[model samples]
Target: MKLWEIAHSRTGDKGNISNLSLIVYNMEDFKEVKEKITAEAVKKHFKDIVKGEVIRYELPQLGAFNFVMYDALGGGVTRSLSLDKHGKSLSSFLLNMEI
Candidate 1:
């Protein structure tokens, strides 16, 4: 299962520190999302590309979730680089995932 399949859609930035906001279809699905689509998961999935801690946050008010993946590119804002060697289209890539 891919992150995007279960998540509604993602919105955020790339290159430096990335903030990825995801919308789950239903609240009940939060567990699955948390358990399966995790920081380690992201690291493992895109091992060569992603790095750092994948922190998750829950927004009950909006019935949404957000993942803040730190140092994902490589080092920090200025030095970190992406697998594409350019940056990622996170929303589209996540949307294409199977989960």
Candidate 2:
């Protein structure tokens, strides 16, 4: 199942980094999400786009995970050539991943 079925996303961008927050609708699904989705998994999933590093921060109290991806915006939005690869769009792409 795709993560989107059980959760939604919020995003933030700074420099060439993309901060994606995956928040589960129900806390019951948090355990599965935490186990299946790792920093390595996320980095691999967005390997082509994220060039630096992917760091995952657990927010279990909120049933969320915040992923900090570096060099992900093609050298920041102002420097990116690709029209479609913005930080905002990455979250949508992430939702496409099957867990």
**Each model's lDDT:** 0.63, 0.90
After superposition, the stretches of candidate 1 with alpha carbons farther than 4 Å from their true spots are 74-88
Residue 77, model 2, lDDT = 74
For 27-52, candidate 2 gives per-residue lDDT tens digits of 99999999999999999999899899
What local lDDT does model 1 show for residue 27?
Answer: 77
Taking all chains together, each candidate's TM-score versus the true structure is: 0.64, 0.95
RMSD of each: 3.5, 1.1
lDDT of 1 by residue, 1-99 (tens): 665656675545566566777777777777777666666665566565456777778776676767777665565446744454324466566556555
Off by over 4 Å in 2: none
- For lDDT, the strongest prediction is 2
**Clash pairs for candidate 1:** 1-99, 2-98, 2-99, 5-99, 6-99
